[model samples]
Target: MHSDKAIITCAITGVLTDPGQHPVPVTPEELAREARRACDAGASVVHLHFRRQEPGKGHLPSWDPQLARDCVQALRAACPGLIINQSTGVVGPDCQGPIDCLRATRPEMAACNAGSLNYLKVRSDGAWAWPPTLFDNPPAKVKEFIDAMAETGTLPEFECFDLGIVRCVQMYRQTGMYQGLPEYNFVFGVASGMPADPDLLPILLRLKIPQAPWQATL
Candidate 1:
């Protein structure tokens, strides 16, 4: 069993949650409030994903570095010593948004999905889920993210949704694409991806490269 004394991280907000529909905060003020709440609840870290502050775009993700900086500043002010973990997952070849955010915010940590996956879901009627999208994280894309994160001295929190992605981290390590100790976030429980069972934790742990620090976020 893992130690009970491990540090807890509260995910203050996500990228695509509609602020009007869910309790996820969107603005800097709301994010600061949630960060304070999490700290009071004994969380030592906060994972963040900014959303556009406009009305219709409130549900979509934001890649604006200024907005990201403002949100990080607000959270830091709220929780004087909380660790910040920024999200940097983006599709397509353009990584400038995420790169700019990292350079602007200079967060302590950030997420980098290790591999591509068909981010699919199925309806009750057996139809495609949400139009059958692809959360692409090709090797080249992964390298691009790593290079950017390295420039900011930020730790890459490898978000692996599948077992194959976990192995990809090892390959990245072998190629010297990612320096220092590799860290992983085993993101399970997605509808089409790996199941969220503690039973599989051991298997995932076994696949971890030697001397790497790893954790799970289910």
Candidate 2:
């Protein structure tokens, strides 16, 4: 069976880029404006990442509860009925910033990285593009985020970057920490976890649990 309609999710801003250089929205007003524009362009949901608005701190992610509250409120007012999916994909073992923002803003959904990844990249000359650090999302950390989301009445959007992470979702469900039908975001194009190759879609689909809502984010 196939449906002609699709739910488009717009990620108005990303955490990794500097807004000044990339031209993405950084301030609350900018986010609200762009989010409304995305809704007008057929987006049913808006995935958001809050950024710092200091004079020279635009490149960094901001975890301030007030900032997140402001942005979320503006978006909700601008785009009525739009689902908000907040970003809680921080790399640290601690969930202070992400958790605080989630509890404060209380979005409809929040991203929960299902597993860890050795975030790495190499240039053509075999030189390291950046530090080969670990994007660690251990089971305990995952639980921490989940607990916060649960408290805030938010749904978890598990971000599975590789096959192993996809399988881990089942284990997480079996452990009783997760309590509902699954939601997955298959992330590709990263130099580490999984590459964005169409040839691998079948294998990835085979690895997923049947009857769960899933989508790919490149």
Candidate 3:
């Protein structure tokens, strides 16, 4: 890779994706192995989401402190220099789990879901696929997460799923909640979020703080 190439972030695991079928890691061994593979393939960072180990609960997200620390330590040993960016997303107002993980493990970076989005989907039959869930990340909650990250030396990578959420990061910067050059992820192509159109990429890029480090997460 050249010095000019954009840093690649491999999201090795995601929220609520059932590990029963998918290859997403549900244990520390798998997490470390997958992270090493991504790093060897030129990914500078790996975004991680821990899952519960209890029987039948392997699909649900977990913020267990021990799991977080074990995964981080194993990843560091396996990859040597890969960046660890832990997922801190959870629906509703209870953020203690995420906060606990952040404080306990204190990864190099953490995902800061910038705003709320009505988690939506549609069936092929022109009806709701599932009940529209409120994936809440209100200002107060965002502030709490940001403050926690600040305390732990973790850089908050704002995950903006929509245009308004993209703009909100700027507001967060101005309102003294964030004091450094912002980092952003312009997430699109979701049913209830911004469209993932090529033409819109530049437009979205233009809306962000000039020269801020950013990446496009498909």
Model 2 per-residue lDDT tens digits across residues 35-119:
9999889999999999889876777888999999999999988989999999988878879999999989999999999999999
Kindly report which residue stretches of model 3 are placed more than 4 angstroms away from their true locations once superposed: 1-3
- Tell me the TM-score of each prediction against the true structure: 0.95, 0.95, 0.94
lDDT (Cα) of model 3: 0.89
Write one digit per residue (lDDT tens) for candidate 1, span 1-218: 87658778888776477778888888999999999999999999899998999886777889999999999999989989899989887877788998899999999999998999888888899888578778898888999889888889989999999998998999998899987779999998887789988898888988988778887786
Task: State candidate 3's TM-score.
Answer: 0.94
Alpha-carbon local distance difference test for all models: 0.88, 0.89, 0.89
> For residues 1-218, what per-residue lDDT tens digits would candidate 3 score against the true structure?
45787789998876577787787887889889998889888999999998888877878888889888888888898998788998999988999999999998888999999999998999999899779998899999999999999999999999999988988999998999888888998887778988778898888888999989888888
Model 1, poorest ten-residue lDDT window?
Answer: 12-21
List RMSD in Å for every model shown. Answer: 1.6, 1.5, 1.7
Q: Which regions in candidate 1 have their CA more than 4 angstroms from the true location? A: 1-4
Q: State the local distance difference test value for candidate 1.
A: 0.88
